[model samples]
Target: MNQVFHRFVEGIVRETDSNQEEREDLYEELLSHLECSFKDYQKQGYSNEEAMRTVMTNFGDERKIGQQLQQAMYPYRREMMLGLSVASLLYAYGVYLSQLLIMGDAHILWLVVAVLSSTALLLLTVRPVSSLNRRLWMNSLLLIHILIFFYGLLLATDVYHPVSIGLTIIASLILLLAIVLVYRTTIYDFSSNRQRSAKDAKRLHFINITTGIFVVFVILFFLWAFLFFSAEMSPAVFIIFIPLVIWIVSYASQMHLLSRQKKKWAYSIAIIQTAIIICLIGLWLLGV
Candidate 1:
């Protein structure tokens, strides 16, 4: 009966005129509701076959039910489509931006990698076989991106010399983009969203502060290193220092925030990172 029920839901999904995500959500909700109803029927002494029959009867005409569900999902379908369109536009613009910003004959490679990354993201969005499959796809997409980012950074450092106008523009754009992305991500905590006390709120605030500081540090350190080695100290180093300022500002802000929130544990972590940064800087200054 369970197998038959799955087949039934899959059939409904096939007949539905909604997007993949909506269809999947509809299938899961319907399956869960049927399971609950089936259990209730069993509790009332109905046999498995009898319960299955009752569930199907209560479910009404599967075709009509699917149509209704599809109709109800129209608004969500539009929103999903809109979001997809936005991503597509962003991907397209980002690729072209790279070509214009990055000097050399590497734009061809950039275009190829960008297309592949965008395609992977698109397929991951629509393909719905299993959670494991989806997770693998997501991981692969992230890996592709990380590799591409590193490759680009390498090109910027080694290939693109005389780091002047184009490099400055690229660094500024990247910094702007990084700051925005980090700000958006740090605004929300993705881990363990359970309810919490005032301390938890403080911890979350502390985490965001640390994250912002780290993000700035990473971006600036790379940019600084690149500019320092390339011997182009115009606006690149200046732009990098903006994030440096943010590092100081973020720490001071965090210190005040943690004190207010009474999350003293964050202080230890902050001190540890500060010590490491100071040590690394001292060693670097000493030509280590």
Candidate 2:
């Protein structure tokens, strides 16, 4: 009976494909289940041979089970491969653009940053080790992507030129606005009923407030750092930073007010935001 049980376990081991640790864990689990079933049969007065036969019969199609286990273990493998492939292609094109924009010149620093950031992005997203890790990774990659792209854009335009810097600021603001709009709208979604929709909207208000404050702090820190690094710090940083502050504050404040059913101040902030954008556009045009 022990020999027969051992043979059945070996059959499963041959079928399973996993690392040593996973294989050992699976082996223990499968062995425990088989033992429980075999003991249950013994309690019914089955002989050893009869119990072994019943256990083996119930085990059923080890090959298929092993394949399913492998698939389950690697649920995100396909998605990771697809996303990483696309990300690589994008970075490749960015490299090409860098060379073309500067007439065969390249920004080695930004190129290195882009490479490292994309690699980290791929590794973190590949396995999703944990939910909190995924969220932190996503937030970090977003900041990395933005900051690197900003630097790359400046490099491509030849950062020594003020016009180039101004253009990068304008472009970054437009991009930031578009992205914030997307995040703001999408974060208040996916409800199956009106009650859930209302609840999600309420949650959206607080979340946007929290995210908005964090973003503002991040931008302020970036501005201070950039200024500290510059021997002769210019106003170009503020050209971008001011509008970003205004837009996010406006958007978040409006969302909060509307969520709390306060319309008057929301409209007031909306008007202020429009004025700020117009003033920034005027400054941008003057610089151009």
Candidate 3:
């Protein structure tokens, strides 16, 4: 009610990772508890300012209390994800720089992706959105992060330095940890939202796995063509990426549709894109 109590509760809620509704609930709960303590102090003959000061002092430091509440509520999951994800990104940057040194050129696309991924991760880390939107954002970013890091690992092999080798090993481990954290985070989100059914859970798992496999296959197919056979079909090598871009666009559209629960449209998009990708792959194989 008063400024001091309001600010104290606000400080605690600021340190938490919660949706808007949960945050409001937490604020009210904490404020009510403090009010009760303040009233009890008044009943024992303390003045208003004295009661307020005593209440705050007994409650302890706002930062420490907030952190403890955050840990109690989330068990350091957010902290773990943020730390590991940033470390993984740093490892990626290190490996990419090494590739630049070894090959005398770097893929500007990877640099752009790294920048975009970092921005997205930072937004997700600091801003709290609805449950559905948060899940979608996290799912999309983590998938792209894993794929790009894997490609970076492939490029890391171009260098033979001890530092590069060690960085690669550390990066690989970080990648694994990121993947596990993403999976567990997804599960934790689903559990927190008790309205989702077992069927929805299975569908999510299927979509994630299918999407990962489809995108990985597409990337590998293009890499194989460009790396091993580009000399023979140099003209067509760049052209092949046209279909890859189209496939990627289709995938993005499918994900949007799925997020909106438009399963029929999403499946239609996937089917058409797969057919187009297959035709493009056939043309490339035939040197067309």
The candidate maximizing lDDT is 3
Winner by TM-score = 3
TM-score of 3: 0.62
For model 2, the run of ten residues with the poorest summed lDDT: 188-197
Q: Sort the predicted structures by TM-score, highest score first.
A: 3, 2, 1
lDDT of 2 by residue, 1-288 (tens): 766666666566554324344456667778888889999999999998898789889888666665566456545433543354355436435554646564566556656666776666566544433223332345546555555555544443553344456545644553363244234323432122323235545454445444444455456556656855888878787764764666566776777776676666666766665565557557867987
| Model 3 weakest 10-residue run by lDDT | 189-198
lDDT per residue for candidate 3 within 1-288, as digits (tens), equals: 388899999888877665555677889999999999999999999999999999999999998897788788778677766776677667667867876786677777776786577567766775644344555667678777777766666666656776778877875776686676567555554343423243444455555555544556567557754775555655656664564466567666766776677777877776675566567668867995
Clashing pairs in model 1? none
Worst 10 residues of 1 by lDDT: 184-193
Selected candidate, larger TM-score, 1 vs 2? 2
State TM-scores per candidate: 0.41, 0.41, 0.62
Give per-residue lDDT, candidate 3, residue 154.
Answer: 63
Deviation of model 2 at 226, angstroms? 11
User: RMSD for each model, in Å, please?
Assistant: 10.6, 11.3, 6.3
Model 1 lDDT, full chain set: 0.54
Candidate 3 runs further than 4 Å off: 82-86, 100-141, 158-168, 189-288
Error of 2 at 2 (Å): 32
Ranking by lDDT: 3, 2, 1
